[model samples]
Target chain A: MVLILKKQVLRRLITIRSFSYDKWYKVESERQKRINKKAQDFVKDKSVFDLFKFVTKEGVSEFKKFVQEFKETDNKNYKPYLEHGDFDYLYKFNTKEDIENWLVSSDSGYKIGKTKASLNLTQQNTGLFSGYLSSDYDKPEKSKAIYTGYANISSLTEQKSFKRENRINIDQFNCFMLKIRGDGRTYMMVLNTPSKYTLTYTYMHMFPLYTRGGPYWQYVKIPFSKFFHASHGRISDKQYRFEGLDVKSIGITCMDGVEGPFSLEIDHIGVLKDNESTEHFAYETYKIPKYISNT
Target chain B: MARRLLTLNLQLTSLNALACRRLLSSASNDDKSLKKVEKTEEKILQKYLRKIRPKDEEEKEEEERKGPFKNYFEDEERNKSAIVFYEEYFDKNTKQKDRDNFMSALEAFRVTNPTKNLYLDFIYGALLKMKEYNAHTHLEAYRKLMEIFPIGPIKCLTKWQRDNMHFPRHQNCAIQILEQMERNGVILDEDFVRLTIKIFGDWTHVVRKAKRQLYWLPKFKNSNPYPIPSIEKLENMKDIEIAFAALERMCMSADNATRIEAYFTDDLEEKTKDNFESTWIVTAQSQKQAELLKDHKKSIPIFVEGPFITWIRSKMVEYFVMKTDPDPEIIEKIKQNENYDDLDQNFKNLHNMFNDPFRDEFSKNKKSDLSVHELTDGTIFALCCTGTGTKTSLFYWTKILEKQISELKDFIIVYKIKPKPSFLVDLDKLKNDFKENQQKSN
Candidate 1:
């Protein structure tokens, strides 16, 4: 009797679940149809005149209000710590020894046994930082071996010179544009930010170089907003904004797990003001939507 | 209406703020002086707004139906008005943006009204003007004009020559247009060829100009024999047939070769010779001999002659066999076969030869050294039928045969096949012969 009663309850629960699922399916289909109709209507009504008409009086007022709110929130919440008037050359690698004074080598082989990496400054055709990395997966414990070669800007030696009178103020500048050439490989641009605690984290932005037309020099701009907070090479949940952080050092790391020779040529690194720079955001994740829907 | 007024007020305030920022940034000073300057700027902006308010009111009162030019680009009748505006003032417009807009509008109109030849003359005139202007946008304008109204090569060449003669500063533009037309599959005519020879016949001048204008000719993989064939070299040819063959040998595509041949043939009163069989045989023989002497160190004297079609087929078969690293024993067996007529049987035998495990091992070992595609009997037979092989395979087997004969100290004798007499005779002759025979019987 108890088993039959339980069977009857199970049948009732199954019927209820199926009924709810059918209702949800009907709602989803209807929503999809509505969205399709909206898309068709949008395409049909599209014209150059409609674009002009969108820049109406109400649109202008709304834009002004948004800008006003943004400015107010920015001023109240986050104040920049460093302020520098002029954008001057903080580090220039014109001489051969400047490389040693500015950069320190770090490789994954230091921690792992089977990986190999090397970094050298060669002046054959042009002065360039050549890095080679090879990985061996035959290591006993590890399932996969990742070889990384990095040249980090030394904070201990360069911090005094950088902070003396030529500190980079993130509020005034739009981006740090680096003139570099690379064999088509993805590399990471790392920035170490000052923290109140002894243990500080680094902000990283990974970008790929496309020199398909041949290895030619190109300027890669890294905007302040593109950097994401990461502790010990792993991303953290707490996000770091560029408004109030003091940047201690900058570095380049090659860690795409592609075990082969890699080289990057750096010509000049300089900060450009917001008005002087053409590109505002280095990465698309920080891109602002150009259009806003009225409805 | 209230919302519109509020929007206008906000826009004015933002504009005032921007202007104040620019002024302050340019002349930043003490706070008190800055305040004084800001107040003066605000007063000036209000006065300016008041002055423009009367004009805005007048414009509102007029309430004229704004033409396409009023919005510049955004209007329902933009296409029509833009066409009219371009037709009227295209020559006078000096701005690059205006020219770009005119070309874009013209393209849009052309797409909508493809059959309308009414505006072609105006577009051509504008194209001429743009060529004279010689700006970076001229190429785009020329491309659009050509796409809309595809002129014949003769007329295009004439126009190019005239343009170059008139404005020597931008002669490269004319060459660029011609190159683009050629890329777009425009067949060159006799007049066009004559004009090109007349203009670019001076090899020295063409080479000098080519240094600056790299797009004048298509780039080839290796060193080109005649990058731009001079008229003197082409004039020595017997006919368009030889000229075309020469061009083809110089790595020109069949399409380009035929196009050039047609151009030269059009000017001649006599028709081009359709029967190039004898000439082709001679040319092929000489070419094969020259290639053998240049490439191979061993002196190999080759003699290749047959009916033109048969000769080409045999050459293809030879190339297909040579490309594969076939077994020497199998090749000897096939060559010594008595039945030359049974080609399909011979091919099957060749296919069966590869089934041996030793041959497979040989192929496997050679696969590492040979980067070319692995040879299969099916592919070889297909290549034989198609008469198409890699460029290096041209007459490859003929050279191999010559090398073998030279090494063996053997001479190959080939006999020409003679044509048989006709079987049909005249009916009148037959009747006369019958009458004569009857007389003889009497």
Candidate 2:
């Protein structure tokens, strides 16, 4: 019996070992890397799924040209975040400068330091906002700024855009901070050159508003048509690209630009770029057909 | 006697010769024509040499006396295919270990003669269940049986599915099936990914749990790296990292440190804390700020971790000492909590930490409960008294602070519970009296 059982068992083990499989080892980070590679390959692979890939080189350039040349609206506050090359960063300034990311509520009411503070010395120089100044440093130029600040907000009285300029020329591209009331977080929008300047580019330099904080996680979407119409001075159905740029990422300016008596906290900042959204690349791609038609 | 003896001897010799020839020749013969005649003639002397079972006559009598053959396999054929059958069934029925041992007997039997279906089924089921089914050694067995029977992956998968009928929808069935599928060379495909996604569906819910279980789940060797990413894959990976970390931490075993290096997605290479810490702190600070502003609460403590809290406590102490007899209760509370432990070696962060103690204190204590106007009033009051305050005579202090804080244009009347003439109108006097009053009351 012992011999029988032993023989049977030994035979089974040896037999089973025949089918025993060896396992291949894989780690997660490696897997993630592979996933990314596969996705990229799948996206770029001509035969597989390249139909949905982002716009390529010529497409980007042409879109920029169209945005610069043909925008359709002039409403001043149609703010937008556009992609650009590298990114626009301003010169760091005095730590104690009284600037804010965007305006929330200032206790009694009204946006203090909401309007760009002009230099008492001359019309040119104004209080600093967080951005690079042209040689016109002391000389005031109307521009929306992303600045650091120190104020515990009571509420955000206003979320609507304020008119910045009637006519916006594509002379400059900028990246700035926006202190929105929803969640009372600082939002950063990087505006590349090919933007609908009059409306899409207004809020960055437009004056501030005060309102109670409500609708914490809500996001607002306005018609892109209105945005296009704002590029012409005020209200004419103007078309302007104000073009030229590429942007890698749009996020909150990494540094704490506001150094008042207190540390100004910043929340996340990103652009909601998607299909149908008018990014520089998207605009350029649309313009190619136009350029072809003209020729 | 001689004539008679000779005649008898001749008869005996002839008979013996004939009998011997028949015995030797007809051992391989077909018929028994001579056996019928010989049996009637009573050739009983050869009865001892006839073929019989290996039982003793007495034992057979005893067995017959006792009962019929206890089992057919216990008969004379015990050494033949009967023993093979008995060995396979008994080994498997008794214990797993025993079945394993009987495999050789079964093999040896097969080597001698192929066992029929009943015996074959017994051996195969036993081997498969014992999880001892081997491809190489049992390759012949596997192949032979497969040729005889068309049940492979389906049998195993179906059995598991039947067993776990109530196993929470597709969760366990999918697992068991896929595992078996992997066992067979189904070739891992998107179906496996789909099954996983189907079982867990949206990554949002189980991203954490699956990430953890994934550490234990055998990971295939593949990687993903790129500039831009897939929307779908991104959705899948959204919360997988945390889940992965948790899985890694939980799945530690002796050899796991090595084995799970593959499962753990965390980079083995060291990352500088500088970038990560600053980002974390900034993110947390901003989150806190958002929470405070939207909710109208204190913004500083959003990132109030141990070090930050400790710094705040120490700053509170400094602020307390910066003036004479600062609220003892507040100082005492800080001392008791010992919120300060191992912290910034130096006090560089003091400014951000409790720099505005009165406002910070009021924000903590009041805004959480008060209406907007009440909150603003307390803040304004604290600000004038503590804002740029100097340690001077109490009388002058009250006069200065009172003059300043009274300018607030915003007001909401709050019902005070003070006793007769207990309240002081002068904001600065109010601060002094309130402190003394709180101390006395406590």
Candidate 3:
């Protein structure tokens, strides 16, 4: 047993290169490189005294946090910067700068998966959202369930706390409209509702965005009522109508698990007032069961 | 030294004599009792032999026994693997590890551990083992696994108990089973519902999950707009046929004039033939697109773009599109007509608009054909996903299109193919470099 243990120790000391570890190291080094670049940019614009002031400010904040035992920040007076405009266009990807309003993230940063989301310019000056989606990832050592391959671009959420969020009231509009051209891939349109409880238990709804693969843009108008209540990628047992008045933000997600290149060009996202058709909610919503009530 | 050795030998002999005398005295007192003691000793030796190497008779008897968990629980090595259907069941001589074997294993485990106390570990082990056995896809397997949980007296009686979930571990185990089934795209049924209610009680979280799946799963099961045939049907179909079906579904319109055709690469003229083996080219073009193609000016270049993916369920088909450059005049016309103000404004002046019927007729006359192919980027003439995404295969498609629309022959087609990966290009160079390095070493 002693000899076996000694062999194991020596084997561990050799540091065999593993795919997951190499990928994790690559991501870490890239992050470090970005930080260095940002530092260089900071130095280019500022004097040494300005750098000292910035460092001191950061140090003072850290000292304050230490003294206070790192309490929860109460930003009750923080105002959201995203403008509230006419319901004609909630999000318009007209220029390269418009990409900043949308945050892109995927499983690659967290796991040994490979995915990317970037802005490409189309001839129409529309933002072409393209990505290489891959589900092939290193499985965790002890886990039986493996999950990866999801790429998302979400509008920036403006919130001070779980209770307070920058919500736009689109109660008048019955349908959510988008003008987009895609390569016939299905995407999910996610609408966030303000969380009444903890952020861990988020309340959101999603519907499939089916794009017709062609040269022309397709105007898809999905009824707000068609959005189903789904939480953390699972459909909720208790069905509820989407609360349009308490809307927080919207997002687009591609997680079909088909590894290939995908592109979707967006002209704009708008809310339409459809007067001809009248449907409240697509799914049935009854009274909550007695068991859930007890909870 | 000799005297000391003799004295030690005498002492040893005296102790042996003393032990013999005590045994003789005991035997003289009760002869029958001494015989009985000897019989018991022989019986114990036989039992130890049986324990060391159990015969086929013993193993069969163990199988016949209803509750054989006592032996299984006592065995440390068997407990570590945690599979109730031991190596004997999955041996080379026995049946293969499949759905039936998996079901039988669950049945055997349930039959043995009737009054189950430490069943949570077994359930978890079975859950992980389901994937290895490839039984996760079967609804019947999930049903049988759920039936493993014992019912009746353990059922929750009160609302609070049910809400808090009586036997929370067991209920959670059942939930994980259902979640696994969902991940594998298995729909819950009436049998599943009955089992959930019977084992976990009606108001428990497990039952609620079942109800949710029942309500939602079927609603979206056939919800794919570009629906292909069922997965089983698609399995037997040729790749070209499946691709054509997906193309047909995507190009389906109310007009019913969309032409979908498949061409074989070998059928092409000898001058254009590129592959030794035949490949297929499936193309779809609507009447509107054909008309648009005819109206295109010959001076401008038409671009053949893509290798773009369109997922028809799990299958990813790559198709190319024939398109023209974005026309600014057409974009401006589209922009001018996108006014929602006219929709609401018409209702306000309903009487005035109705009084002048000629004005309404004029507006109706000016209305253009609404096609998804007409866009600011360009007008799409046709789309085709080939067996091989090569320029030659695409050329056959354009030739086919040319026969239908003669105007396509006059237009210059430009190919904008995405370049092959750098590694593929560098492989030959790397081979040469390796050869040079080997020569230098020599």
Candidate number of the best DockQ: 3
Which parts of model 1 are misplaced by more than 4 Å?
Answer: A1-87, A108-121, A124-126, A137-170, A202-213, A276-295, B1-442
> What TM value does model 3 have?
0.64
Off by over 4 Å in 2: A1-88, A91-93, A98-107, A110-171, A174-263, A266-295, B1-442
The residue pairs found clashing in candidate 3 are none
Sorted on DockQ, best first, the list reads 3, 1, 2
Write model 1 residue lDDT over B1-442, tens digit each, in one string: 9999998898678656754564555444446545765787899999988856756655543222221113322336435444444444443433554556666555665766666544433443354344234322333454455344333422324434543343332233345445434332233333443344344432222222332233222322112222323333433444433423433332222112111212211232234555211211111222322333333323323232221111110011111112222334443443343122233543222112122344335333322221111111100100111122223222332433354335323433222221221112344688999999999999
TM-score chain B for all models: 0.20, 0.17, 0.62
i-RMS of candidate 2: 32.3
Which scores better on DockQ, 1 or 3?
A: 3
Per-residue accuracy of model 2 over B299-329 as CA lDDT, tens digit each: 2221101111001100110011001112344
Q: Could you give candidate 2's per-residue lDDT for residues A179-268 as a string of tens digits?
A: 222211122222222245554442211111211111111123221222222221121112343232222112122111221111122222
Best by lDDT: 3
User: Candidate 1, which CAPRI tier?
Assistant: incorrect
Kindly give the stretch of ten consecutive residues in candidate 2 chain A with the minimal lDDT sum: A206-215
Pick out the ten consecutive residues of candidate 1 chain B with the lowest summed lDDT: B310-319
**Interface RMSD of the predictions, in order shown?**
32.8, 32.3, 17.9
Q: Which scores greater on lDDT, model 2 or model 3?
A: 3
